[model samples]
Target: MKTTLQRIGMILFMTGFVFSVCAQEMEVTGTVYDAHDKSPLVGVTVQVKGTQNGTVTDVNGRYRIKVEKGNTLSFSYIGYLVQEIKVNKLHLDVYLKPDKVALEEVVVVAFGTQKKNAVAGSVMRVADQSYYLPSVIFPYPREVNTEEYEAFKENRFLSTIQHPLSTFSLDVDGASYSNIRRMINQGQMPSKDVVRVEEIVNYFSYDYPQPSDGYPVRIVTETAVCPWNKKHNMVHIGVKAKEIPSETLPVSNFVFLLDVSGSMFSANKLPLVKASMKLLVNNLRPKDQVAIVTYAGAAGEVLPSTSASDKQKIMEALDNLQAGGSTAGGAGIQLAYKIAEKNLVKGGNNRVILCTDGDFNVGVSSLTELESLIESKRKSGVFLTVLGYGMGNYKDNKLQTLAQKGNGNHAYIDNLQEANKVLVNEFGGTMYAVAKDVKLQVEFNPNFVNAYRLIGYESRLLNDEDFNDDTKDAGELGAGHTVTALYEIVPVGVDVPVGNVDKLKYQQTKNDVSLPKFADSKELLTVKLRYKEPDKDVSRKLEVPVLANRMNLNASQDFNFAMAAAMFGQLLRNSDFKGDAEYSDVIRLARKGLGNDPNGYRHEFIRLVEAVEQLEK
Candidate 1:
């Protein structure tokens, strides 16, 4: 009895000791303000010195962090001098001073109805001029030119007899389109390397029917006379993914991976990023959950998983982010994916929505390393959403690589209006996926075609055999998304400027071996598509034979619009295959294709062409 009583006393003593330690760790609440303007500064990083534990100032410049006794806290913000203070009491306030030299390094130019001559007599070195209403114009006065894009050669027409099968992945990403749009609107011609013709054409939705055969995606095919060259025909392939109602959409487990590097301090960068994030948060369902992870020279999680119902808290987290330090993109991604996996919502939408300028100067910055890291994470069934921002030093190649490897989508947010389009208006299509690893393989028939070339998708091309391999990663189809692909065809009797393949000893013709099942059919081409259910490993197949259609003078508006976009992209890149493509032709096709454009996006495209025409003159 005496020993039992002594054991109970020891247990009580240990419990009391634990309670005392917990009591000593107090919640420190504080507000950060700019010393110059005396305004509440949003996105101030409030962190415990020498540790990863930190929090960001919210929309109101308020931050709350639990700190142990005698722990020092560091406050940092972009273009602001850092301040460190010891945590003593429950309440604390911080005032940060702006660093003038740092401010000068980041040029702030006028935008959205502002004059070309902006702050501090900075005449934005524009290549052309016509301010787009949705504006994000900043001059790289310091470095002058730093934007990066992967260079790729245009696809060439192949002899139908030698190369009958053309396989490539399907993509719904619109980053290339918007990024170029920003360049053109900023009075600069988008470099050829940055112009992705497929992305440009697929940016706009076509009047294709959704899935009705119990599958998540449907295939629609059409034919029209090539707008650029009447002698050459164009085949239009449209894939429309089924749409789910917003209310019935799967619960989302989102981790907002943000780059808070010094490069993102410009108005159109970090500030725009915060605005864009808020737009997405507004569309989140009550049952959805969100967390935030930030990276500068190092990576840290600023917010833990919190219910979307607590939207105010989420917005606060976004507001508290400010940019400073070098970019650690790889570390940020790793930390974000880890947190997302930890809070995985089984059988639901699990994603890491990374918003960055795509600059990675610090640890794990190599493309090969990031690719391997993302490849491993893709097996975890977590989707990725990459949102590119900023211009000077923007890493387009890295962003595209990450998106493709992760089986995710990419978009560029230039302004608040664009943010609304992607995050609010098109919320369902941008955030949720219905089909994963979508790929298309086209077998052109020699009987109907002499030569053929896929209009775009040079970067998405795949080995023909990879179509059957479920392990190969490909682009994903989001809910309510429509992906459009075009093929330039030279009919059997028609001829175009292209090369012929040399006869090979091992080559086996249809007569030498055996004819394909559809070789004798009247089909112009056979399109075989493969896609996996978002949660599955094995893929399902859909095959459709497209019958040849003689050139049509009256093509559908959807086809016309897509053709216009294709022609515009080709002309911009000065593609050798652009035969007779002209700005006037782009304007004409775009005008004719402006059917039921409630959002006025088509009309805007027409105006953009006019602007480019003026630039050429």
Candidate 2:
């Protein structure tokens, strides 16, 4: 009995010792992040609340510091708002909001600078410091052949571009109405009441030059046998815009003319727009400017011009913008233009960025009225960039016209990544118009080319007469921009899509054997481009050519990349020209042609395409 009691006492003493040792030691660990992008933030200050003991975040925004079990932790960064958290567990997730007054919240406004508080209108600004893969477009769709497609999958090339190449048209529905004029003049005629699809796509991206020094953005361009008409070749081109840092690059005057009409009440409409705007706001720097102008039955500047420095005021204005009443797009445009004119700044970035579901229902609803209104104000030195959001009953037609006549660009935001792509990843190129009144003319050589069809740009084809007219307005290009076009050529011996004359009509045709015969023209297509510096009234010309040949679709990466883009566009619009095009085939070609995906935009596109397919189902 005595021996047993002694053993029990010893056990108690050891147990108590163990407990004391454990109580004396505690671990505090957590992951820190930059509030802007939930990306891990390194170099942040982490300290015990009210105590001097603290540690900085490591490379991955991770930290481990010894502290009392119940000690509160304070997290801080130079440009971010500080945060306090209780240490409940060893592993924790900490997010730090941006500092409201530290670095000026830069908002890109039209032509000037304003404190965030003074700016009026629904404005979204973004600041991203990440990198995305570069988007490389095939010079022409026929660059790819089957052999190259196979080679791309075998690690033959280090990188490749994605699909859905950029397309911009001033008139949304102009593709169907002005084909002949567009082909000659390189300018699509204005449509009365329809939206142009290409303009919507072109509005967001700037024409930044390809990264010449770094890894060249690789792309597979291809031409394939048209599934519906084997007599013609289908060209595909792919593009992927690389991501870079978000910093104090340029100051822009941004007027957000939002459409809050009753038609935009759908879940994806106003709500998505608001969210998108917020994301952009969170990205602003203190040096930028922004304003909010909303149109619903009437147009009003809810917030005056303000600097990005005052975020609270800017955010408050954004929060106050509500959706109601009919859409008075013209009124909104006029007010926005007025605000822009008053705040015009020379040599600085000036642009009004409009966000809408493309639905305009109320006053001055005609496209002509809106276009004329926009055109008159464009001379005031402010440019336009249109962002189309939401779906269903969308008025793409009007938005396209506004962009074309206003000397601007257009884009469609379907998801958050795309929102980032436009607002954060590529802000400068999107908001700053480096070149204006841009036009493209491709003169085909009748000698070498038997027949040819320009795949897209049905609306952008221009008349030769309009080329030199300074009064004629055209598409605008931003800094470092690239423009691509595709032509499906039909050789003399091949049966092409060109219509055949009736046998009876041909029988009556006299075979005139002219004594003077000329050699067949060797030129395939002559591409002539005219553009003006953003602030200039004159135009400059650049010329290139589309060579004639039976291009191996798989032999060239450019060919594959281009075809993929064309097919993707066809899928999006479901064009009447698609005939027998299939999404499955698009996927197959893209998979075989996809090369090094640095930014994952191509991968995301594939997912988007799949999602679209599912929705179709």
For all candidates, what are the clash counts?
4, 105
Off by over 4 Å in 2: 1-249, 265-267, 500-512, 515-521, 549-555, 571-581, 608-617
Cα lDDT tens digits, model 1, 201-294, are 9878787997997999999888878888888889989999998988998899999999999888765678678867876888788999999999
TM-score of 2: 0.61
TM per prediction: 0.78, 0.61
Per-residue C-alpha lDDT of model 2 across residues 1-617, encoded as one tens digit per residue: 99999999999999998777656547777788877889987555566776545555644677666776667787765447778787667788898887655334322232333344454532211111111111110001111111100000100100001110122222222122121111111111112122223322332122233533342121223446654445665443322223333474457777888887766554345545665676677778887788889999888888898987888888778656556798888788889888977887778777787888666667777778887888898888888888876433445556666776788776666434455666666665566655677665545444444555555555455556676676778876554444444555555566444444443544442213533343355544455556676778987665554455645544343344445555655554545555566777666665654566555645544554553343333
Error of 1 at 438 (Å): 0.2
> Model-by-model lDDT, in order?
0.82, 0.55
Q: Could you say which candidate leads in TM-score? A: 1
Looking at model 2, report the run of 10 residues with the lowest lDDT sum.
148-157
lDDT of 2 at 422: 67
Candidate 2, position 562, lDDT: 42
Error of 1 at 114 (Å): 17
Structural RMSD, model 1 = 12.2
TM-score of 1: 0.78
